[model samples]
Target: MGDLAGRWRELNRAYWDERVPVHLGTAFYGMEGFRARPDSLKGFETAEMGDVRGRSLIHLQCHFGRDTLSWAARGARVTGLDFSPPAIEAASRLATELGLHARFLTSDVYDAVAAVEGEIFDIVYASFGALNWLPDITRWASVVAELLAPGGCLYLAEFHPFSFVLDDETGSRVTHDYFDEGPEASGGPGTYADEAAVTEHNDTVEWRHSLATVVSAIAGAGLRIRFLHEHDHTFYLQRQSLECHDGDIYRHPEGAPRYPLTYSIRAEKA
Candidate 1:
């Protein structure tokens, strides 16, 4: 477990440190909208986890804290955590600029839960594209369960496992095994920040967890599954032929009848 956490920390730090600066400059994060309105959270996140007013919320893998800050503006006592120092620093700065009350921590998820003492959140929130970076969903679920106050809720909206099976390099082709546990390796052409721009990084690593694995892990950690919802829309262009239909939601132009692009689930710790 120590080795796994260490390796994850190394990969996440490298990946996110590089991503933070790029993401800040992009419209994908709605930085300008956030600065102006202070309530500019991602549509997928806002639609799924509604009304956090006066609730204590903890956002895991909260890259640079746009969503966290947005939640704070909506009156949630927010704490955003990320393993990347640059992300935490940027989040803190953004919170300060917006005059939003939020705390940002730079620690691996496993360690951050342990480090933040005598505190439990009313809502534990995470969003799309977060879980893949984690190597161990069981441990991550345990940490979520631990940080959640009794009867508190856990909310997640993530890219569906079905979407991951498709080959993004080729248009709408099923190329990767859905249940495969082998490490999927890649050196970046650029991250999802700006798909049109090509930026090179010598290293990037990620692990994918299946839907069954994710649900079992959360349930195994003593959380009760409330509802699991699947959707055909994605927040980004997953492949060359993907078309954005309603501003943010994207899908294959040719339409694959079998797969969904995203899923959302809510669980309660009791």
Candidate 2:
């Protein structure tokens, strides 16, 4: 397991390093608008996370730090972590360009405690397309608990595991296992940020973790679950078949049936 995890992390780092330039130029990440507005926070993040003013936040798997900077903009002292060096470089550049006092560290999330040198944060925020990359939610949860100061909380907004079972290609059929602990490997046609951007590097590995596993992991790490909220809409185009409604929000077309497209968990260390 240790050897597999190390190799998987290397593969994912290479994948994400190659992906950073693509994401930087893609309209999906909205780099231009982020420069103008400086707050790329989603409604659920604002609603569920409340004010981050004067808090210390560490964003695991931060993926170039747009969200991390967004939290900093709201007055949180922020640190962003990712395994990709190119991503950390880009994130640091963005922070300097925007005059935001944010730190970007390159480290696999499992090693986040050491990367931050045992520094405690008031909030540990992971969102959107994170968590699946981690093969062990139990260890991830422990890391989250380790990073937080006593009474500090974790806010995780992720795609629902149920949604992961559905075929994103068809958007109406079950294709993958919901409870599989795996090194689900695949080569991609293109990056999710820009489907048209041609890329030869597509090696990727992911795992499927159920909600029970996630919740139990957090609880076992000694964090009290504050709330769990599930949503029928996503802030990004998770599936090609999903329809865009208002803004960047996407959902199943009318009458196609609704399911929990996303879920949020707020857990606190006592």
Candidate 3:
């Protein structure tokens, strides 16, 4: 929103640019496996979204576009956007490789409406690892409001903020405050896609938007809350002891305790 924020976004952009090459090759993304089962969305996401045949869908912060192309595979006319140019470029190339007709654009989520040339969509979408990168949930929600046609919906699948407060390795206990809205800074060598893999740029800033904060922002932007669903599982290894199942979904190992690890919200423009 200001020069400082712009600089922070740049820092993140560089970090993400670094993750792209590593992500493409990693087993976490499972690019080769993605080809066989093109629609990589979780079971809950598909059920909540229902039949999207012919609906116009825009995926914000759509990394490399597997999920975006997955929507295309489901017959939604899809467009994907990300702040990182390299990510958008990869998405474009992937679309071509999949023989899927879709548009991929490079734009920060805050500037999404203008980036898309003022086009509106039937479904404005985003998922895990998206909301936290944004500094201002209110601004993000406003963009979602602007980009959706009347009666259009915003569907977000994201890691629960509560999950983040817990210890990183075991989900053992709270290691941070749930209410802290941070442009928290962290940096080093690797990414969530492959933690051990080496990389060039690692410094980045992130924010944690609590469930209430996110829902309220969307509501304040004039979107009606349709449903907010919390899940016991998440898509990635956010914690160390989590067990991976059915490809990418992760859960608390066997008989260990469980709490809300991920959530989805379906809100509509009134």
In model 2, which regions exceed 4 Å deviation? 1-6
lDDT of each residue in 142-252, candidate 3, tens digit only? 999999999999999998999888898788888999998787776678877788988877777788888989999999999998999999998888888799998778899
User: How far in Å is the alpha carbon of 37 misplaced in model 1?
Assistant: 2.1
Alpha carbon lDDT of residue 9, candidate 1? 56
* lDDT tens digits, residue span 139-258, model 2: 999999999999999999998889878887768898877767676775486787898888766777888788899999999999999999999998777787889998789998888878
Off by over 4 Å in 1: 1-6, 40-44, 169-172, 195-200, 254-258
lDDT of 1 by residue, 79-170 (tens): 99988889999999998888899998888888767757858999998987888877789999999998999999999988888777777765
Q: List the residue pairs that clash in candidate 2.
A: none
Rank ordering of all candidates by lDDT, starting from the highest = 3, 2, 1
Q: Supply candidate 2's per-residue lDDT for 100.
A: 95
lDDT of 2 at 83: 90
Higher lDDT: candidate 1 or 2?
A: 2
Q: Estimated TM-score per prediction? A: 0.90, 0.94, 0.94
lDDT of each candidate versus the true structure: 0.81, 0.88, 0.90
Which residue pairs does candidate 3 place in steric collision? none
Question: What 10-residue stretch in candidate 2 is worst by lDDT?
Answer: 1-10
Ranking by TM-score: 3, 2, 1
